[model samples]
Target: MELQQLFLEAIQNGTMEGFFKLISYFQTQSEPAYCGLASLSMVLNALSIDPGRKWKGPWRWFDESMLDCCEPLEKVKAKGISFGKVVCLAQCAGAKVEAFRSNLSTIDDFRKHVMACTASDDCHLISSYHRGLFKQTGSGHFSPIGGYHAEKDMALILDVARFKYPPHWVPLPLLWEAMNTIDEATGLHRGFVLVSKLHRAPALLYTLSCKHESWVSISKHLMDDLPVLLSSENVKDIKDVLSTLLSNLPPNFAEFIKWVAEVRRQEENGQKLSEEEKGRLAIKVRYLKKFSKLKGKKKA
Candidate 1:
């Protein structure tokens, strides 16, 4: 909806906290197809997420250029990013993301999410929708939902493409209809993403890998088989249990053991480690010793 046509008075009574927070960080797309990048950059800065690297000479900020970790800039420039790619980029930048495609979601469900995001100052929403439904001049576009007029049921879209259009209010049902359309690039329905700050945890020495081809079986072995094998009276020696365990693990498991040994050597050489790191290393060392014992049993 056009700015003149929208009831601006209703927005004051509705949720305006998110709108106020986002307005200061609002940015225009650098390139014609940089709507996703610009929208994400605005949300990231509004949430006070540090980019951890300098954008210009001395300033560390989130810009369209800084958001190329997930998809290369050249590719995103040639063809605009997909809904899933936006989610990936947001997550890589340490923002918590909850994405929903119109195809996989109901209008009622979308309304609830829209209301929740607009109600809080801690989160913001970015909608990916086709412009045809809005009678606009583009295909798929990305824009942040600054606020929602509850009584009017209209959402304020802070359009990143400032040259083409101004920030306007769109009706909830009409916006949902626009998002329900498919993007030719992804062959999936356009959608919206709720972006918020990720609550970080203390760094760990090691993390589980699910990228392995046999990850499903590996996880099952760790969860079910390993416990039973450890407690089994039929297991005569620890070597037998170790053998059973090692056989289930991927071949790259040895590489992890090698890495653990390297860390131990570093510690022996007077390298300082965090208490959490040291504690985790100790557990791995104990497991390594068991494997060593199993190897010695095999040699005998």
Candidate 2:
């Protein structure tokens, strides 16, 4: 069934699935000129794309380090990433993506396509942004839609450039006009599409490894923080804290990295860790028992 029919039928039959699909999304952080990449990241997470893959042997992993982010966006020099570049990079990352840009596509056709695409959980959609739908001054931009609200004729746009715009409930008709506008940069239409991972298992495991790395990352930061705490505190309980922390250090940094990567796969959703992330993770784990503290001593 097409999304338009699905939503209509769901509403007629009194079901809510047609209107909502909860997914994760994050704002573009630090990379001022990477909204395309940021939008890609949001869609990847929304669809749970793992971005990692296995080699021919199924035992060896493909080296993800060779994936140059900027190389794919070759058209983007100092300007924002073009829709074409976004498609290229996403294809490299193993995403199933398509671009919708045709002068022949009428407003009604786009309305149905957008409604069908955003109405399903299997679909992850993103498109260009403007001040009218988003209330932002800039017109040519990229963002994702969480789902659609048929009753209200609104589409939930999960804007990736969160620093500049919060997510909004945009009317589908208005958003369609925004998507159809010609981009002078590429002379292409601005619209979103459904994105999903080509490979499932490895990507999921890769995601899990990230969460594990976060857990391990906290312990690694303790390496830098512990020394400071020990030196600055006159509190007598400090010795016990130091002893406990030191004892918790990984026996060997390399071994810990190997062990963490090896075992992390068994973790819920975390089935694998990238060799690059493993190396960096190990570097952070090195000297987990070391650090300094300074304090101003005020006489009582």
Candidate 3:
């Protein structure tokens, strides 16, 4: 198979060997403005679906030397390459944040890093991760761009965040770590925007917490503000949370319906609830004793 085909297939099957071959292929090119960007994105897509794959095989080939050959943003720009592709490539190689930071020693390097992190459609935590990885010189504290330019860029970050993507719908533990990190960095605590970014891990967390109100209460304390930012339209994507909540709530469909009505009312009024809130409400409805009797009444 051609290298491109091999790369595409490797991404589909999550094979480390194919990725290794692709990386080898990537190294041969001296003017890798476009190819490097594409190759990086492919690597990201492959590893994101299976982060564990990085533990061995082709992933190991991506040592410091390989990272060094990547072209700087300006060099890529001067060569007329699309900066977006560069962002995508770094993102794919899982080197986005790190790549930008590694080069942030100069004022120009810092500008590129800021632009990459705040790029629309880029994940904020990824930006945060990169910033955290490469701390500023002679500064014990980290700030998300404290100057005028940084402030301007933050507006762009918030705007990009509002552009919603389909739910990730996968289960991942690392997402939890990301959430905790965001909490510490922003001091915002409990909002759906962060959970939504977790892709599919929110479902898992909701499931575990639903059965234990104590657990639910504790986690909610940490992340309750999520629903406030989510739209009713997006609530449909996280219906699984509602299903779990309904399953565990006290048995009373009427009361459950009432709760749904309340949430629906909030949703209608432009309120957003996190998966936890939706799940909590769903379980309460499912457990309603009225539902059990309704089953018997149908038979009678």
Best by lDDT: 1
lDDT comparison, 2 vs 3, better candidate: 2
Each candidate's lDDT (Cα)? 0.80, 0.55, 0.31
- TM-score order, best first, reads 1, 2, 3
Clashing pairs in 2: 50-203, 126-192, 131-136, 205-271, 208-270, 228-292
Model 1 worst lDDT run, 10 consecutive residues: 204-213
Residue range 187-246, candidate 2, lDDT tens digits: 766665557656544321223222223445555656675567666655368577766555
lDDT: worst 10-residue window of model 2: 291-300
Candidate 3 residue lDDT tens string, 1-300: 443453344334332222232223222223323233333333333233222113345352332123322345555534523323334334333343343322223334434443333332222222222112123121011112111123222111111111121112111122222222332323332111100012333332112212122433434533663344343323455575565444334333333343333343344453466787677656654564466565457546
Q: Flag regions of model 1 displaced more than 4 Å.
A: 1-11, 204-300
What is the per-residue lDDT of model 1 for residues 193-292, given as tens digits with 9 covering 90 to 100? 9999998664444433232335555567678878876676356787977677665554445444554433534444534677876787777667777876
Quote the RMSD, in angstroms, for model 3.
20.4
Misplaced by over 4 Å in model 2 are 1-23, 53-77, 102-104, 132-135, 199-300
